[model samples]
Target: MIRPFAALLALAALFSAPVLAAPAADAAATPSWSIAIHGGAGTLQRKNMTAEEEKAYRAALAAALDAGAKVLAEGGEALDAVEAAIVLLEDDPRFNAGRGAVFTWEGTNELDASIMDGRTRAAGAVAGVTTVRNPIRLARSVMDDGRHVFLSGAGAERFASQRGLEPAGPEWFATERRRRQLETMKAERVGALDVEFKFGTVGAVARDQAGHLAAGTSTGGMTGKRWGRIGDAPVIGAGTWADDRSCAVSATGWGEFFIRAGVAQAICDRVRLAGEGVQQAADTVIGEVAAMGGDGGVIVVSAEGETVYSFNTAGMYRGRADSTGTREVAIFAGD
Candidate 1:
C-alpha cells in the first residue's frame, strides 16, 4: 500500500511513460486503395455554365471516376487504373484530350500525354502527336516498350503505328466546339491566349492494393498554339510524377507556367523531403504557381492513401474514389 503522495507520483509516472503515452494511431491510415483525378482548371463560373452543361460535365467526371474505381476495386495495378480513367476522358468530346483536342495554328490537333509508374520509377511521354487515338495508351506503350522514355512528332506517330495502336483521322479529333474556339483565338490575334480557352487537360492518380502509385496526364495542348509548342502535359516531372516513397501527382493548367515551376514534382518533393501532408504539399505548390501568375490545379495521392485536389483557379473539374466504395465529383471551388 503506497502513501497518497506516492500513489499520485506513480500515476503521473505511468501516464508519462512513453509506451503508455505513445502517439495516437496515425490518422492517415494506409488505405487499401485510392484514386483522384482532374479534368481541367480555369475560370469556370456558374454564370458561364448552363444547367445542362454543368450536368454533362459532372456526368463525364463521374464516368471517368467509375472507370478507374472499377479497376482499383478489382485489385488492378495503379498504372492500369490511371490509364483506364484517362482513356475514358480522352475519348469524350467534352474534354480537351484525344477526341476533343484543341487545334494548333496549323489547324491540326496535336495531343500530348505522360504516365509514371512509382513501383518501377518508369515513365513515358508523347508530344505533338496528331494521329494516336488515345495518347495515354501510347504513353503506356512507350513505357512498356522499355526502349525509350519519350517520343514526339512524326516519330511518335510512326512508333504507334508500328506498335499496332489505332490511328485516328483528323476528322475524328476535330469537334465543332474546338474549331469554333480556334476561330475565336484567331480573331483575337493575341499572343497570350485566355485561360478559359487553355483549360481542359485530363489527368488521374492512384494507389493500388499493392501500395504502388501511378499518375498520368493527357491534353490537346493550347488552342492556336504554334511553332511546335509542347506543354507540361507530356513532360515527366512537370505535368506528372509518381513515387512509391512519396506521392503521385497530375497537373492541369497553363502548360508553360507548370513547366517552369515543375508543379507536379514539386508537390511530391514537398511530401517526400519536407514531411508535408499531401494536401499541404499540393496547396503550397499550387500557391507557388499562382504567385507566378499561373492558374491551374493538381490532383495528389500519398503513399498512405491520402488524396488532395488543390487549385488556384475559380474551379477544377475533379473527382475521387476509393476501394471502400466512396465516390465524389465536383467542379466548383467549394463543391
Candidate 2:
C-alpha cells in the first residue's frame, strides 16, 4: 500500500507526463503546412464593387481556402490541395477560369492550365484546350501520363478524352457576362493584353505536412484574344513552378511579361540560390515585371513553411490559411 504522500506524488507524475510532452506532441501535429491562393490581379477597386459582389467574392475565396485547408489538415499532399482549390475556382462562375471563362475574339472559350510538383520537378500543361471540364485536371493527367509536358488545342482535348477526363461543350463554358465582355472588347478593339480584362486567372500554391510543395494556375486566356493565344497560365516556368529546394509559385498577370521575366522560376531561384526569403523573392520578381510595364501578382509557399503574396495591381483576389492559425481572405489593394 502506498502512503498518502506517495500516492499524491504518483498522480502528480501521471498528470505531469502529458504536460511535459505537450510541446513535442503539439509541434508534431502542427507541421507548418501552409497555402496561398489567388483568383486574379488587376484593376479591381473597392468602389467599383457593389457590397453584394464583394460579399460573393469573399464567400468564394473563403470556400476555396477551406477546401485546401481541409486537405492539408487531413494529411493530404500539396498537389492534391492545390488541385482541389483550383478545381473549385474553375467551377465557380464568378472567376475567369472555367465556367466563367472569358471569350476570345472569335467568341470561343479556350482554357489553359498547368501544374507542377516540387518533389520531382514533374510538370504538365495544356493550352487552348476546349471541351475539357477542368483544364487543371487535364494538366495533371498530362503529368501523370508522363508522355509529354505540354499539349495544345485539339491534341490536348484528344488526350483528355483518352484519359477519361470530363468533357464540356464550348457553349457550356460560355457565360453571358464573358460574352458581353468579349463584345465590349471587340467594340473597343482591345488585344490580348491583360489590361482590358482584370487579369483574371486562378492559381494556388501549397506546402503539405509531408514537406512537399506544389503549384497550379488556370486561365481562360484573355478577353478578345486571337489566333489561339496561350497565356502564362499554361507555361510552367512562367505562371506555375515548384521546387522543393525553394518554393512553389502561381501567378496571375500579363502573360507576356511573366514569360519574359520567367516570374515563377525566378522567384524560386532567388529563394534557393540567393537565399532570399520567400516574400522578398516574390516582391523583387513582381517589381521587375512592373518595371517592365506589366501588372500582376503571385501567391507562393516556400518549403520552409513561409507563405507570401505579392502584386503590382490595384487589387488581387487572394486567401491564405496555415497550421499556425493564420487565416485570411481579401480583395482590393488595402485589404
Candidate 3:
C-alpha cells in the first residue's frame, strides 16, 4: 500500500507541476505553416471543364504550389513565396489573370494587383496598368521602395518600365476565350459579370522557409467589366491583406461589395479583436459578406498555421499544400 501511495505521489508530482504550453516553438522551427492558391471563383461548371482541361488546371495549380513551396523550402520569406507562387499563375494562360486577363469595355486590357506584408503592414497596388506583365512583382517593388501605397494607369506603367520590367503589348492580353466572353457580355448588355454568371481569380498565401506569412492576389477583373472597374485585387484590405499577428487573406468574387466591406481586413480584424479562430473568423466574415449581397470566396491562413477556404458561392477554385506535403485542390464545396 505504501509503495502504491509513493507511486501515486510521484505521478501527481509529474502531472501537477504545471506543464507550460510547449514553450511556444520558434516560428522558424515548427513546420506549422502552409500555402494555398486560387485560380478564381465563379460558377464553374463541371460540364464546361473537360477532363483534359481539368487535368491541365490541376497541373497548373500543382506547379504554382511547388513554385511557392520551393521558396519556402529555401527559407525564403513568406512574402517572397507568395509573390513567386502568384507569378506562376499570372504567367499561365489557364487563369483569367496576368497573361490571359480579360478585356475592358473599350476593348483594352486593364490589370490590377496588390500585395501585403504581414510583418510590416506595408502594401502596394496598381490599377488600370496595361503593360506590366507581372503586376504582383511590380506591387512588391512599390511596397519595398516608395512610401506610395497605390499607383494607376500610364503612370504605373511608366514606373514599372523604369524599373526595367518587361512591357507586353495590349495584344498580349487578348485570349480567344476572353474575346468570345466579351462578345457574350455585349450581347447580354450587362455590367461586370451578370449575377447569373461567374468568374474566378488566382491568389496565394504562403509561409516561407522562415515561417513568415504573406499573401497575394492576381486577377483580370471580370470577363466584361466596365468603367475602370477594379475588383478586390487592387484593394489592400478588400482583396488582399496580411499580418504576422493575425493571418493572410485573398478574396475573389463580387469585388464591389467586397470593397465596400473591406473583406480581407474584416476577417483579420475579427480574429485579432474578437479572438475567433481562423475557421470561425473566416466563416463569420464570409457569412456577413454574403449577407451583404456579396458572392465569392476567400483563401485565409492564420498565424497558428490554420487554413480556411470559405465561400458562399457554389464553388471556389482553391489549392493548398502544407509542410507535410499534403496537397488538396477543390472547385466544389464538397468532394
User: All candidates' lDDT scores?
Assistant: 0.84, 0.85, 0.76
Could you give candidate 1's per-residue lDDT for residues 211-330 as a string of tens digits?
999999999988888899998999999999999999999999878878999988998999889999888888777777666666678888899887778777667898987765557888
By the TM-score metric, which is better: model 1 or model 3? 1
Across 225-310, the per-residue lDDT of candidate 2 in tens digits comes to 88888879999999999999999999998788899999999999999999998788888898787666666889888887777788
In model 2, which runs have C-alpha deviations exceeding 4 angstroms?
A: 1-31, 191-197
lDDT of 3 by residue, 266-318 (tens): 98999898999767777777666656656677888888666667776655677
Instruction: Please rank every candidate by TM-score, starting with the best.
Output: 1, 2, 3
lDDT of 1 at 17: 13
lDDT of 3: 0.76
Clashes of 1: 0
Report model 2's TM-score to 2 decimal places.
Answer: 0.89
